[model samples]
Target: MSGFSSFWASQNKVFRISIILLLLASITYGQGNRKPFAIEGKLNLTSWDIDQNPIELNGDWFFYWNQILTPQDGLLSFNQENKNIKSFPGLWTDYEGDTSYPSFGFASYLLIIEGLEKDKEYALKVPDMYCSYQLWVGSKLVASNGKIGRDAESYEPEWRPVTVNFVAERETESILLNISNFDHSKGGIKNSIVLGPVEHLASQKTNEVAANLIRIIGIALISIISLAGFFLYSKKLFTYFSIFSILWSVRGIFSNMYLIYSWIPDFNWTLGTKIEYLTIYTSVLVGYHIFHNLFPNHSNKIISWASIFINSTFIIITLVSPAVMFTELLNIYFGLMGLLLAYILINVIQAYIYDEKGAGYLAVAITLIIILFFYDMLSYYKFLPYNPYITSIGYVILYGLLGYTLRYNQLHKSKDTTFKFS
Candidate 1:
């Protein structure tokens, strides 16, 4: 077979594979649209009508403290030597007989009631408190919040209740509650926490005012900076693109925070919101412009090909996949960015190898930008504790580099003018 024919066959196969993958992703997304079960937030203890049977899980029994665990044979028993009874269902402050907050707090409850049923599903409803809380039914640790459940890690305080099914004893049962305050370092103060029964809300008034304030402040600051840039740079195409990028970024963050839809009641807010797409698109445009600026001559085919492939793949994957796929897609984007950065860095190094002037500083600046990008991605993925704002550090360095390049060009022009006069 001819070499051209072989190349054509290879290209055809690659094209077919790409088409198949796209189709598969689309199909998978479409098929996985089943509605998930809705779990209600925090339970209300008061006015809880027993639909099936009455299984009271609330009763005060005993208290104690122990760092190490030992076998015990009591319906209600814990280390009481650390006698310091704080408050319940909330931040425990103003404990009697204890000057400072106890290192740990544990309490058990025992209740005697005439109406009790067997083989009924019951749950211990604890108010959202400072740290972690554990519950025990008949000496068995039944339910735990912020420690045993997935909802524990999230700080969003919803009225979601934790349910645990228990086997009915021949007689009445004992319920124990153990709560631990993980840290008091940040001046742990008193807060509201209450155990309550479950009830449909009379109103679903989400607390969006605070979120709106944050969004407004963030967006306003970004807008001011963009406007200043327009004034400073004469509204050039690059400046405008950068402004749009930042506007989109602000919008994306705000929308993700649900500030836009929440504050603007008239606006139709959908469950599956893709408002962040605008931000992603604007970012790509800015990146494209940056690439053009970095490689003005467009002399390297490999760099151009690789960048196009990576960016095109990112755009397609992001558009087709749902938000849940963001974790996986973000990894792809991060990898692409890393490779593109390394490619640029290699070119910078090559420039220096050729004894090129001003290449050293450029190399350092590029390295810094790459490092910042990696750190920002890590932080975004929750792998690092660094601030998300770290990504903008690269933008600062980029602006400084552009200014230095412009000033150097002007100086070089002056040298040429002097030579001509001479």
Candidate 2:
């Protein structure tokens, strides 16, 4: 008992330090050399240094609702009074300038960037918008994803993050974005556009892709090892965890950097969206089974069965329904999953109180998962600032802890077998 206490005490200290470091890092990264945002469609960066960090082109921008205006049209026809100011990195559904806007519609966004170094090369990182978009930098169409149109028949929806590089032709530049969404529940720019030095933005993109690749590779390895362990030992715990990890790996590929699209550029967006949702649903089912198996005495059978049934139903709906329909169910799923996670947390805590093997480690892992889950939800809904890599970081730490707990259990079981034989 004393040895266990001592071990747990050391682990607790390590866990606390790790959490503190993670929070400090998040804060530091979130506030990295902040710059002023655009106000009423203009961003002044004359005195701001571009070498410091990439700037998110957030704040108010000239929004022309229901009008797919081009650079020529905007320059010749529209003036300051003709435009409506709307915040960037937000959906048109939330736009309430002159009137309410629905999720489906076409719109044009314009932002004039002032004080750029003339003739210097810069890069703009455009995130995945709702359905389709075309971007023009000073009358030259620089980059586009999918096909943009004024309505559903003419519009084609595609989602891909792109970085455009162009030289600054003048001290001030104009950016025009024509976006249209007819197939999804949300429309308009969903994420901030990033601008920085060409080399800096390029390096940043490379680092992000590399990090995502590493995480996917790591999760894939864990799934493979867990499956091999299951086959060798015939343990249901290993099987459950293996499935859980595999689902997460699939989800990871489809999300964050959308790495799968790089490999299959023509992959169907609807199918990809379904796979994303199905992975989440199935992961919860498998994850709950893992905990129930680990602490059967503490886990409630009713809740376990209920989770299984609900998740299974969700999986079926996601597989059959269209992206627009199934995507709306995600918020409801999150609410249910939150309750399920709370139940699992309570069970883990009970197991730890009763000194169940590996409970302490698992409790910590589950706690971290809960925190990251909420963080991701808030971030997704635009309630909080986006951090693309935090959830991946949390999952990596979770897998490490689970791996340690599994090894610890195996080692102790081997000792028990040896003692019995002796």
Candidate 3:
């Protein structure tokens, strides 16, 4: 294992390049945007009243500076010397008061809104900034994130909406926003905050070209791994692959275009959104299998327990009401997937340390998957700057691991058969 690990360490450069190229190729070829704008039909509500609920205007918000819409992290920060640095959408301390926030340059954001209720209250909240901010509703100052003392706990941006009640004089509308960065005195400042819609809208497509490429790559890898498993199947391999493939295939149906058009023909606008959540739920089970395969322990007891725990939790949330589980389930799946991936990587590392032949390949594969997974996870919660094209990198890794296992088992069987015949 040590020898194998050393070998991988020596070839890290080559492995990294290959994995990155493979990931890029997958995204480019497999997950091309088939429908730039396909209505899932889920939002076909009968009444103007239901649609009138305050929807969060967070999705597809654009940043405009000097009359140009800037991409995510487009603000170039500068010091007193005026050198360019990085910036984003959140509160930052200027190394002032006891707890200063990060500083950033000025940037304006605009959100396009549809189906908003008139004569209703809506809040444009930035959780906490501990500093200063200004909010505008169509050029009207709704609430300014005014400067607050760092000593005040409420001064920080809390993960809550800053409410703004308004009487919409007209039916359809949009919001123009201007946020100033006054943290010049603060040391090396950046902002990264999520602009929220009242209700979660269809994930706004991100204009991040790198992230989109990652998604396409993930999809292609998943397709290849799925095919790989199908081609090399022994009894055990077939059983596992059957379960894995069916689960993801069903999940893909809910996620990809095929299911949207077939199953829920009369889609409510929210149906597609709902299916996206469901895909996360099912992917938890998929993670369980991936972990079990990659980090096989002498005893299956722990894996069984973990599976039960995950399913039980999901079942309980579903029983309580789906909405209760929305954010919570996402968090759960995210944590579980992370743990599974970590365990697999650890096993691969251990295998390499023990001089195992295939551990290096597995490690490279896991590394690529993790890179893609982190981007998707961050994008899902709006933590990372990305477009809504969710990358399927983790799924690709899981299927690849499954395929490798099946292939290894079949080869072992063939070798054993040859020995016996001889």
Best by TM-score: 2
Q: Which stretches of candidate 2 lie over 4 Å from their true place?
A: 1-34, 370-394, 404-422
Ranked by lDDT, top first: 2, 3, 1
The TM-score of predicted model 2 comes to 0.85
lDDT tens digits by residue: candidate 1, 3-60: 9778767786778797786687566555433212111211222233444222222222
How far does residue 82 in candidate 2 sit from its true spot (Å)?
2.7
C-alpha lDDT (0 to 100) for residue 340 of candidate 2: 83
Q: What are the lDDT scores of the predictions, listed in order?
A: 0.42, 0.79, 0.43
C-alpha-based local distance difference test score of model 3? 0.43
Worst 10 residues of 3 by lDDT: 35-44
TM-scores for candidates 1 onward, in order: 0.36, 0.85, 0.40
Model 3, span 1-422: residue lDDT tens:
99988877788687979778668755644443221111211111123333333222222234433222222222221112332111233223332334433343344444434454555544443332322344545435565443322222322221112434445444444444444432222311133233234342222322223343444455445555555554554234344445555555555544433334334444442344355555555556654554444335421556546765776576455545433234335665678757765655666688767755445666666676667767766554434444444454455555566466446544544332121100
Error of 3 at 394 (Å): 9.4
Using TM-score as the measure, name the better of candidate 2 and candidate 3. Answer: 2
Worst 10 residues of 2 by lDDT: 413-422
List, residue by residue over 218-320, the lDDT tens digit for candidate 2.
Answer: 7878888887876676554676677888888888889878877778888888888788888999888877777766666787767877987899999988888
